[model samples]
Target: MKVVLQRVKSAEVQVDDVSVGQIAQGYLLLVGIQDADTVAEIDYLVRKIVNLRVFEDSSRKMNLNIKDVSGAILSVSQFTLYAQTKKGNRPNFMHAGKPEYAKEMYNLFNDKLREAGLLVECGIFGADMQVNLINDGPVTIIFDTDSNY
Candidate 1:
């Protein structure tokens, strides 16, 4: 499991020129799943994201979590996060999970976020999506189950 979390003022996703999911103020999550991912990895990422203190407090210090700021979530399935480009100009997607398995894990990840009392919106699992967002503070964080960065 891997996620690129961005603090956003607003975010929205569209599929085929139709709006699919949107959020007001929250984290825009680009999620990627690998064959080795499981519910355990999902649980870890969700907890870390929700409780991440990216939002600034009254003192201008980044001390508030998403829940504290009453934020929502816009989750999108993104296999490209695992794109392997070692050999040549062409990118290999062998590190990414198959669609069937990836979709299941993606849904599970969103469900876990919703169950945590966060308003979670999502893009279609296998659809071509267009995402727009105003990155608050331009704060971005990446989490991966396999390596520490």
Candidate 2:
């Protein structure tokens, strides 16, 4: 599992010209799943994202978590996050989970986040999506289940 978390003032996702999901103020999460990902990975990532203290507090310091700020989440399935370009000219997707498996895990991830009491909106899995966002502070972080970063 891998995730790119971006703090955003607002965000929306569209599929086929129809807006499917949108958020007013929150983090825009681009999620990726790999073959080795499991329920444990899902659980860990959700906890970390919700509790991440990237949001600024009264002191103007990045000390508030999403839950504290009452922020929502716009989760988008993004296999490209796992694109491996270390070797050849062409990117290799061998590390990315197959579509069938990836979709299943992606759904579960969203469910887990919702269960954590955070308002979670999501893009349609396996669909061609267009995402728009105003990145708050342009604060972005990349996370991997394997702690690669």
Candidate 3:
């Protein structure tokens, strides 16, 4: 499991020229699921994301979590996060989980986020989506279950 999170003033997702999901003053998440990912990884990430203190406080310090600012979440499936590009010119997606399995994991991830008390919006699991966002502070972060960083 891995997620790329960006603090956004606002974000929206569209599929086939129709709005699917959107959020205001929150984090936009690009989520990836591996074949080996399970509930444990999802649980860990949900806790970390909700508690991340990247929002600015009165002292101009990044001291507030999403919950403190009543922020929401916009999660999108992105299997490309697992793309293997070390070989030839073309990237290989062998490490990306099988579609059906990945969808299950993706759904579980969003469900966990909502259970953490944050409003959550999501793009279709396997649809072609166009995302728009006003990045806040351009504060981007990555959380991956396979890495210590």
What are the Cα lDDT values of the candidates? 0.94, 0.93, 0.95
List clashing residue pairs in candidate 3. none
Candidate 3 wrong stretches, greater than 4 Å: none
Model 3 TM-score relative to the real fold = 0.98
Model 2, range 1-149, lDDT digits (tens) per residue?
99999999999999999999999888999999998899999988988997899989899999999999899999999999888898989988899999999999999999999999989999999889999999999999998988866
Order the candidate numbers by lDDT, best to worst: 3, 1, 2
Worst 10 residues of 2 by lDDT: 140-149
> What's model 2's overall lDDT?
0.93
- Residues 1-149 of candidate 1 have per-residue lDDT tens digits of 88999999999999999999999999999999998898888999888988899899999999999999999999999999999998999999999999999999999999999999999999999899999999998899989889876
- TM-score, structure 1 vs. true: 0.98
